[model samples]
Target: MSKERAQRRAEREREAAVLAAAKAAEAERHERREARRRAVASRLPKKRRGPSGVLADRRRTQTRLLVLAFLVLNVLVWLASGDWAVRILALVLTALVGPLVHILMTKN
Candidate 1:
């Protein structure tokens, strides 16, 4: 019985050692992959958008907002008025004024 117990203890120790080795290998592999990724990322070019790019983005945002506002206002007008003539008039006015509004808002 004592021999059997000793054998079982030895088996358990062997399994523990194998598991520890596997864990260490996995940690090493993870570190290697992360290092490679960092090296590649460091080589990539950094995007530097200057003042013109910023201004262009701002103008684009303003234009989009203006278009959204125009659409919402047109919808409101259509809902508020039952007359077809009033809806048509609203559409015409929006078409005429939209470009002017865009130009004024986007002008530097």
Candidate 2:
């Protein structure tokens, strides 16, 4: 009876070891498959934006430059005249003119 019990315990240990080895092998295969996928993706070329995106980018840059120029002009107005009301009015107009022109130009 003692010999039979020893044999059964040994068999259970062997089965558990086999199961652990299978789990390890499956995880290694998954890692290798992921590596292969990343390598293939790296070899593909990146896609670029279309013409509409280019046009939108150009409009963005133009609007940014217009705002920068308006700020500079506002500073110049304040430096030259030094009046609170005049400076405030110039600043408001400077801020409004760019978007107004953009609206007018893009109106359909």
Candidate 3:
């Protein structure tokens, strides 16, 4: 009875050691992967993050506003006018506004 108890205790210790070793290996692997990811990220080009970034964000907002305005204008034109010529004219003008605004905004 005493010998059987001793054998069971030894078996449990062996299993615990095996589990601890597996956990240690997994932690090491995770650290290695994180290190590799950081190294790769460090090599990438940094994004613009100052006044230029602010200007870019502002420009994007302006562009979206322009698009929304043009969309609303086109919808109103189509809804208010029954003439095909007027609708086509509004579509053409809306298409031209995007490129013209882009050109004006990009001028330095």
Best by lDDT: 1
The reply for model 1, stretches above 4 Å from the true place, is 1-52
In candidate 3, list every pair of residues with a backbone clash: none
Error of 1 at 69 (Å): 0.5
- Residue lDDT tens for model 3, 8-100: 999999999999999999999999999999999999997766555877788778778878888999999999999999999999987977779
User: Could you estimate the TM-score for every candidate?
Assistant: 0.51, 0.45, 0.51
The per-residue C-alpha lDDT of model 3 at residue 65 equals 83
Per-residue alpha-carbon lDDT of model 1 for 1-108, expressed as tens digits?
A: 999999999999999999999999999999999999999989999879755787778887898999999999999999999999999999999999999988987888
lDDT of 2: 0.84
Where in model 3 is the C-alpha error above 4 Å?
A: 13-52
| Model 3 quality (TM-score) | 0.51
